[model samples]
Target: MRLGAHISTAGGAYRAFARAREATCDSFLIFTKSNRQWAAKPFTDDDIAFYKDAVAEHADLHPVSVHAAYLINVASPDAALWEKSYLALREEVERAGALGVDFITFHPGSYMTSSEQEGLDAVTRAMRRLLDETADTAPNTVVCLETMAGQGTNLGGRFEHLAYVLANAGPSNRLGVCFDTCHVFAAGYDIRTPEAYAATMMEFDRVVGLDRIRCFHFNDSKHGLGEGKDRHDHIGRGQIGLSGFANFVNDPRWADFAAHLETPPTEDGEDGTTIDMNQVNLAALRGLLASSSA
Candidate 1:
């Protein structure tokens, strides 16, 4: 699999490429804009040129993706906020397309006080509208709906939620799924053992057609199964231990797909030492591949 992490676009958008390249990654993800902010400065022609040039410089960065802002809520019951989210996501996709990003991940949003069916319908409608707005350039990009931790009334926690979105969306191949291991485990799909992992995957195949899944967010859950928490921990040291990661890393079906680490970033502490946790987590994942090799 092509493994990487979410790199910061702090200094400039193009810097994310350099960061990922320095990490010796095969792929990487970025937030096109501040993930907590609702508005963003438009991407200039220079921005696009710089990003393209960086990608050309780093031939190994196969697929650079963007994660949508946390504030977007297309599934909200509030009409004004829902429309705001639809436009926000539409803008995000436009920005990603401009940057030559082929993949973008977004949470399917929460229902708030609405019923589950209401939330599903809202997401379906918003998706249709968003797709319609970007139909011209969407062929170059795949919008991935991320699996959630099922906290509160969040959508896409269940495979059924994903199925509903796919079934209701416009007939477009650009729509896909991004499976986060931590969220999947926290949402009650067991992956800590061989039989359990196989069973959980089989269920996904049956309900969501594993074909729709195109990427992975490789995080171990800090909470236990069925906890519905969204905590992420470094690989092996969490509730979903190395056994879980080994089962996933060894799965031949996802060999060509992109998997990225969303674990906490490395912080510089007192001494001259640095703590890049992604390296540790990524090493653990790679070790699983060798140890589990047949």
Candidate 2:
């Protein structure tokens, strides 16, 4: 697997590549805009050029992904909110295309008191609309729907839910999946042991099909199995712990997938509290894999 993290694009889109490099990442994830807000600053030609140049210089870094804003919820029952979500996502797709990113990962929305079938249908329709609108642009940039935490009325927490969305998407190659470790653990897919991990992944292959998995958000869970909570802890520090990540990083099936750390930045002077945690996680994971091979 190409190891990396979600790096900040504070200066410009291209600057994120430098940040990823500093973190010793072979791949990275970035947001095109402030994730909390509905509005985003328009991209300039310079932004596009800079991003293209940076990516070209980093040819060894494969599978760079763009994470969609948190505010979007395609399954929203509120029509206005759903429209806003669609437009925002559309803009993100265009921006990602300009930057030449391979995939854009987004969360499938919550139902908000709507029936499960209704919510799934709404998400499917919205996704189809997105594909139609952007048909002429960014054909290579696949939109990856992330699995949710199953909190409240959220959809896509189940592997079958993601499979449903993919199957409903028809023949479009623009759709894919981004699996989050914390979310899946919270949604009750056990990864704490090698046997359990194999079982869980086999079930995913049987349901969602591994071919659809494009990216992974590598976070440890602070909550236990079946907790339905979405708290993320640093690698090896949380409930899922080091063994869980060991299983994840050692898996050959994910060799081509972009594995990114979304853990919070560590504070100054605190032990293990730095962005270098990405490097630390990578080293630890490598050590584990080496021992297992022995």
Candidate 3:
């Protein structure tokens, strides 16, 4: 896997490349605008140029992705909120395309006050419309549906949910999945052992073809298996121990895939030194690779 982190774009989107390089990232993820708000200042032509130039400068970074704003809920049953989210999501796709980003991932979103089928149907409609609208403009960019922890009415806890969206939304290449380890584990899919990992992956493949998975969110769950919570901890310090991660790190199938760390930024130690957690997590993941002699 190409190990990395979700580097912040606090200043300009171009700055994320330097931050990713500092963290020793092989690739990275960034939000095109403020994640908390729906409104964004339009990217000027110079802004897009600078961002593209930075990406070329860091040629080693493969498949740098964008995470959609948190407020987007394409699955919302409410008309006004749904329209707002769909519009925001559409803007996200356009921005990604304008910057030549390949993947833009977001949660499938909460059903809230509706049946699961209704929520999923809403997501399907929004995805279809989004893809159709951006077909000519953003042909190369794929919108990825992230796996959620099944908290509250949030969709995408099950593989079937993802499969449903993909089946309904596209026969288009623009739709895909972003698998999150912490979310999947919390949703009751086990990967704690090699056998468990194999089984879980097999189930996912059966329900939703492995080919649909385009990116990953590498996190460890603070909650246990089947806990249905969304808290994330450090790579091996959480409920998903090193062994579980080793299974993913050493997998040849995903050797070229980008997995971004969404874990905490810094950790305080006994000596009062602040540790760079991304470096620590990357090292831990890299260490999982089998020795040549083994």
Candidate 4:
């Protein structure tokens, strides 16, 4: 797989490229705007030009993606919240398209007060509308439904949930999946051993098809298996050790895929100073790759 991390776009979206390069990323994920906000300042003509130029200069950082704002929850039964989420997601798609990103991944949404079937149906309708409305604008960007940890009433804890949306959202080239390691492990899919990994993947293929996976969030789970939590820890330092990661890094089927690290940074110096842990975590992952080859 092409290893990378979620690079922060703090100063400007264009600056993310430099930060990614600093961490030696082969690809990367970014938030086009503030992930916690509903509104953002419009991108100016100069901003667009500089972003495109930075992408050109860093030609090696291929297959970049944008994670949609966390506030979107299209599965809500409430009419107002549903409409807001649909619009927010639609805007996110347009923004990702404008940036020429390959994919836009998002949490599938929570059922909250509704039934699982109701939530599934709502998400399907929203996805259908999103694809139809953005066909022209987001022609090259695929909407990836992320696997969740099943915290509270969230959907997508099972592969079947994702399959429901993909199967019912009508046939479109703009739909896919982003498999999150921490979420899946916390959701009960084991990958700590070779046999367990093979079984879990077999189940995924049966339910969602391996071809639908376009991106990955390579995080380690802080909680144990089936804990249904979303805590992220450093690679190989949490519940999922290096052995679990080895199965993923060595999988030939995903050799060309973009696997991004979303792990937290660590403190490396005295006086509680923090360090960029992307380099550290990515190095550990690379070590797994090297050992497998050896």
Candidate 5:
């Protein structure tokens, strides 16, 4: 399992590699710039060199993926916001490629005012255009659409939404999905039992093809099935529980997939003083594997 957390890129973007190494992460996610803001100073040549060197030094942290800015809303019914979001996403993809990151994932965005169909089409079109514009620039980095908790009118709560986006993008360009366990549960795909987990995965495979799923955001939900809430809890401590994760963790099919934690970090990195929640959660996941295989 490629296990890690969303580590901070506070001092410099390249520092995230060292932090991943410190956390004992095989892979991790980081925001190349600010998560809340759109404007960034740009990644200088030195910055790229340092990042590449750090990544090379930590061979285990090979596929450090970028999480796109939080403010992007390409599904916005407002034309101005949509355009701005499209441009920002394009910039994000380009930057991630330049840094030689493995993947860049983004929220599928909300379709609040417009009809869901229109919103899906809008997002799909934007993806196609972004891929076209960054064809040569960002060819290596895969653009992944993340599964979302069904908060308000977010587009990716259902598996179909992601399938539609991929269908429109076609097979040639770089495209994929990031399946979030908590979001699927909040959207009503139960995985607490073996039978239920199999059923849910079968449905996903039918609609989107499991091969298209490149990464897993391993989290537990604070809410129950179909709750539409977006709260993430510690692994095994939430409603989804241990069995939900065990089934996925031990599956032979996804043996090589990355399972990343978005759980809250230990305050001030104090262990004994403050718990390393990531280590705790990762241990919980590791414990599940034996039972699942048995």
Candidate 6:
């Protein structure tokens, strides 16, 4: 698997490539715009050129995925919010296309007060609309819907829910999945053991058809199984522990996907958060994989 982390894109889109390289990442994730804010400064032509040049320079980095903003809610019951969400997502997709990224990952969004079926329909419609809008520009870029934590009315926590969206989507292949280990564990998939991990993947294969899994958010949860909590703890320091990561890292099926660390930084230093504990966690995971195979 290509190991990486979600690096900051504060300076410019291209700068994230350098940041990821500094983190010793073979792949990386970035947000095209500020995740928390609805409006963002428009990207200049220079930004696009620089981003393309950076990607060309880092040709060895197989896949660079862009994470969508947190404010989007395609499944929102509120019509105004839903429209804004769709527009924002369309803009992000366009931006990713300009940067030459192949995948954009986003949470499937919450249902709010709407029924689950209605929410699913709304999400599907929004996605179809976005695809239609960007059909001419970003034909190669796939939008990856992420599995949620099942907190309150949030959707896509279940394998069937994701499968449903994929099946109903107009261009099925245009849609994919970014599976979060913490959310799955919180949603009650036992992946801490080899046997359980296998079982969980088997279930995913049966329901969502593992082929749809394009990216992974490699976060260990702070909560226990079936807790439905979305708290993310640093690797091994959380409830999932090292064994769980070992099981995942050793899995041959995820070899081609980008497994990214969304965990917090380790320590502070003069050079902007000098120490990153995620590197240690990734090294430990690699060591575990090597030892297990040996």
Q: lDDT per model, in order?
A: 0.89, 0.86, 0.93, 0.92, 0.87, 0.86
Q: Please list all clashing residue pairs in model 3, or write none if there are none.
A: none
Q: What is candidate 3's TM-score against the reference?
A: 0.97
Candidate 4 per-residue C-alpha lDDT over 155-211 given as tens digits, one digit per residue, 9 for 90 to 100 = 999999999999999988789999999999999999999899999999999999998
| Evaluation by lDDT, superior candidate among 1 and 3 | 3
Give per-model CA RMSD: 1.6, 1.8, 1.2, 1.3, 1.9, 2.2
lDDT of 6 by residue, 105-144 (tens): 9888999899999899889888878888988777888899
lDDT of 2 by residue, 1-294 (tens): 888888899999888887788778889989989999989899898888888898789878767899989999889888999999989999999888877789899888888978888888888988898888887778789999998889999998899889998999776778999999999999999999999999999999999888888889988888998789999887888888888888888888887778888986444455644446767766665666735566
lDDT of 5 by residue, 189-253 (tens): 99999999999999999999988888889999999988988899999989999999988987888
**Minimal lDDT window, size 10, model 3:** 285-294
Off by over 4 Å in 1: 267-272, 291-294
* Model 1 TM-score, all chains together: 0.96
| Candidate 1 CA-lDDT value | 0.89
Residue pairs in collision within model 5: none
TM-scores, all candidates, are: 0.96, 0.95, 0.97, 0.97, 0.95, 0.95
> Which of candidates 5 and 6 is the stronger one according to lDDT?
5
Q: Is candidate 2 or candidate 4 better by TM-score?
A: 4
What lDDT is obtained when candidate 6 is compared to the true structure? Answer: 0.86
Clashes of 3: 0
Top of the candidates by lDDT:
3
User: By descending lDDT, how would the candidates be arranged?
Assistant: 3, 4, 1, 5, 6, 2
